[model samples]
Target: MKAKILIVLGLLLLNFGLQAKEKECIKLHVGHNEVPENLIEKKKSITHTHHLSGHEPVHIENHFGDVKVRVWEKPEVKVNIEITANAPSEKKVQAFLEIVKIHSEKVNGEIHFKTDLQCLASAFENNINGGDDKEERNFLRVDYEVWMPEGHDLTVENSHGDVYIPRFLSVLNLHQNYGNLFADHLKNERSVIDLNFGKGFIKSMKGGQLNARQTALLIDKAENVVMTNTSGNVKVLMADHVDMKTSYGSGHIDKVSESCRFQVKYAKEFILGEIMADVDKLEIESSHTNLELPLCVKGRYDLSTNTRNTDLVLKDQPKVHYITTGNDAEKRMLIGTTTETNATKVRVTSSYGRVEVK
Candidate 1:
């Protein structure tokens, strides 16, 4: 009878030991990474290189915080995770890691996690985008610092964290609904950035051949540029081959060396700084705004403008078709200089603003 009791107690202790073994704790050094210049005073970015053992599906998710992940090839696939944090204390970091352990799960294999003395929530503010006026910021703030090899497929999502990467080459798709995301440049094309902003700002690519889309886009001296925006200040300088679209913002294009294309729907005003290129097509819908364009193009162009101001002018005949849609005051504005030969087609439509060829 005593032997049976002893055996039962041993099995119970074994079960508790196995359960504890499944939960592991890790610590990281706090002086390894660089936070932003402004954030360095208030917060810090900590880098960590963690490892995972065996095949376990590792899931790390943060609600309103920054997150970064990297995978590398070392005979066996090692998951090295790096985190930049604005956490306050070592004790808080330990507590936050415990919270992370409760939520972190191993799907592919077992993970040996390592992090810094600060909590992950210290990296960014944890304010949800809308309708969350009653909750406190109990989650951790984590600014992300991720680096992977050439072919790691990763997906990152956040609520109030801005995504910033200095350099990395991996298949990455990211979206930030309420913060400004910035990437200096991609070293190679293996890295793909898919980003969105809610009320914050977004600055994706500076120069070089980049494929970028923004709710409110901004560009300065880009080679091949494509910009779309709702209502934000946009500036373009001496460059070429730009395809642009806007709803209710001003566009300034100057000294473009090649043929450019622009489609503006509802802008309060329009400004063409200097059009020194042969335009392929400058199709504009000036609903209740002003219009301006250069006199010539290399090939064909579809020029259309609707203005309230009746004194409109076109100094040359367009090579393609000149289609006008508006009142008689809009039609009488297409005045030309030459008795006319081969010129790019110019179309005019006026409802409420002036049109000019400058």
Candidate 2:
């Protein structure tokens, strides 16, 4: 019996030891790999400063990295570029760094800065031809930080990265994809933005045009602007003389001071919060939509619906004249008018949806 007990204790100790050893092996396997000296990342920085004549347009193009632009009081354009290359060996990294470059020049009175990665294709082809499997871990990226004078026309194009501009007081032409744009204030004669698969946040815009696809845009205040979106959502807190078009999306306009027009199709919901008394014209056309609008007592509204429901809540305005024609089975027309002499003209048309006016 004593020999049997001793054998059992030995087996239990062995099992515990095996468990501890297995845990240690797993911990070591999950740990991060130590980087070798040859495999360390190589970095390079290039800076260029050009004294501008204050009338030249600055254009920048980048891919696979971020671009940040800020305004300065100096009459010069300064660009700082950071390049990073990583590969399996120091020699491979050096090869990649040799081909990746930034090309900057003055062409037709325009300052142009572009990322030159065309030679990388040849480098990759050479690696494939040589049957090198180490190219799989090779990567190169370039980022830009630019500072320029105010009132200069600036254009930037980027892909797979973010673009940030704090305050731009000039014409801006910004195009981006698979990224986001954050602008504090853009004030100028004209600004155009084209974005896809991204989000845009503009705190204030004086006059601009925005074209977006699969994006969400938020503007705190916009004046004399035109916006078009596809499969996106737009929200504007204060809009003046703005025209907006959205398809397969949604929109919300909190307040309108001058004039506004909205065109929405296949939208989830569209809401217009309020219209000031100074508004001259307000128009809305929608299909397959759910919309909500505020009824103004000093306005003349002409509403038409085709095969849909209309809910007009006029509990507070008893002095208003409201009329309805046609039955619920077909197209219907409703007109509401107040006794105000300089009443604003409001038109709303909808099909196969609901309209709620209060």
Candidate 3:
């Protein structure tokens, strides 16, 4: 009996191993390649820290690599930078490092820090001005980890890589391209962020107003939000007022306290969650997309659909009074609802798309 049990256990283990290998093999077939370790060189690092006497804004701009900024209670600031260059040979790495300069200066109580890429910029300018058309064959990556005092303002900009900030209580201006951004907590009156192409996630952000533009955004809590995007997805859990404009994207917000407004230019899917009667207005306009709303509406609504179908699914035990109208000759439909005490007004317009309510 012991020998039989051992054989069965060995077969099971072998089957599991084969399944894991098969999964990995499938991943490889789908454009996943494993590169050898010796092809890339190790990163070079430079670190520095400083103490400041005044509370002025600090600015950091990097070309390529990640940037992380944090806040602490101490009265000092610390910075750590990592640099990596990719080339065919070690001589090229040394030559590239000689041209790039890392500069940090304190001017009038403000700290300015950056990795200046003047050499490449000059090369590009020369190439554009009828000079040698030889392209730049080298690239530099600089990553930063910085910690500053709490309540200190910051202005950070990067071209490529992720940007992360744990907590901040002052003004913030962050811009980036082709990387993700994350913020844990924010306690500012207003903050501005713009990204060319990347995803952004914010949690527990409490502010009077916020303006964010990116490819994709996900937020847990926010207030007075204004966002614009070209093509991506947006999800919000709880917010007071949201105004959004998207060319091609989808949105889902769980709860809106005051108002929700969206202007979509192309095919986009928008979904809404619970809505209170205290909300003044809810307006949505889409060109060729589907819009879904909750079934239980507490106040009043006015919805219209053009060249498409409209579906309204009511609850088993309904409370509000609903009135609907349609013009079959013009292929247009209108729906309206009302409440007793707190009246909410919702207006939606769609062209060549469906409007679903449930």
Candidate 4:
């Protein structure tokens, strides 16, 4: 019986060892490759050649190797090519370069080619099943740099690297898998960013203007702005705008303007210290609990609580609208107005705390 048990244990260990070997991978090559200059500069010797390219723009979609490109002012738009090798042969590097050259020569609209990292997700019967020498199943890194004729627009798809754009570029639509994205000025109306979970902590350190989505929207020095996070807080500076419908976290207190619609919805996260409802219209909603509004409201005040508590501090305003406060139970507050005998809008309820609106 002991011999039989030992044999079974040895077979199990062998099977597990084979599975472990299947998970390991060889060297993973990533980053950009630079193009040679001789093939581009020496041949196009017509007149002044700088960065002014009246020539057509270059476009590419790389799948294997790094891509480094530089657009120059030249006749008969020439393209330089380079690639990196990762296996037993240096021939792959040369072969890829030659293919890029040929493709550039034939294609229209300047040149369109790519030499970046690609995945074998479609080739395998099961993407999760891979040998030890295989790359990671979830991520594939393709690094490249393409130089356009200054005013050209760039569109990248599912990339994982830094995107660099000059100040006066037309529009930059960037999407990343796992990296930081940087662009100079977003002066154009089309300069919009759609980001997915890859750490889009952005700043316009060197640019004329910046524009992000409404979720990350905040006025620099002009109009009021509002931003809401699906799973985080919205931070705005002083002389900024109103915020609404955000989950988990707080907003900055110093900034409040009339141009923005600012309010916070009920959340599991905490909102500490004065939630300044300084806007014209202040609206708040909390369920299953009570909320405290520390500032006075001037515009049409609409407050609703379904089985919750609401507390407000009314300001001394001449023209105030109907204050609608709802509750399935009792709520608490310290309310004092200009004239306690005659106030504009006041409603109260209770499940636990005292109600005061005067």
Best by TM-score: 2
Against the reference, the lDDT scores of all candidates come to 0.41, 0.71, 0.62, 0.34
Best to worst by TM-score, what's the order? 2, 3, 1, 4
C-alpha RMSD between model 3 and the true structure: 14.3
Predicted model with the maximum lDDT: 2
Lowest-sum lDDT 10-residue window in model 3: 1-10
Tell me how far candidate 2 lies from the true structure as C-alpha RMSD in angstroms: 14.1
lDDT (C-alpha) at residue 108 in model 2:
91
* TM-score for each predicted model, relative to the true structure: 0.51, 0.76, 0.72, 0.46
The candidate, 3 or 4, that scores higher on TM-score is 3
User: lDDT per residue, candidate 4, 68-135, as tens digits?
Assistant: 33443343333343343232223323222222222332254434544422222223223332232222
Per-residue CA lDDT of model 3 for 1-358, tens digit only, reads 0000000111122232233333211100000122233333436777767676767778888765688997777787778888765434465445444545678888778888888744444333323221211132334567899989976788889765788988787888888776778888776767777776777888966653444454678889767667676777778888677777776778887887777787776646877887766787777777677777774345344433343444434333254354445564222222234433345556676666666665
Over 4 Å off in model 3, which ranges?
Answer: 1-36, 40-42, 86-89, 122-139, 208-214, 276-280, 297-338, 349-352
lDDT of residue 112 for candidate 3: 84
Off by over 4 Å in 4: 1-141, 149-152, 166-169, 204-228, 232-258, 262-358
- Which structure is stronger by lDDT: 2 or 4? 2
Q: Give lDDT tens digits, candidate 2, residues 20-124.
A: 333211000000123234455777899988879959999999876679997788999999988776656565456545655688999999999998764433333
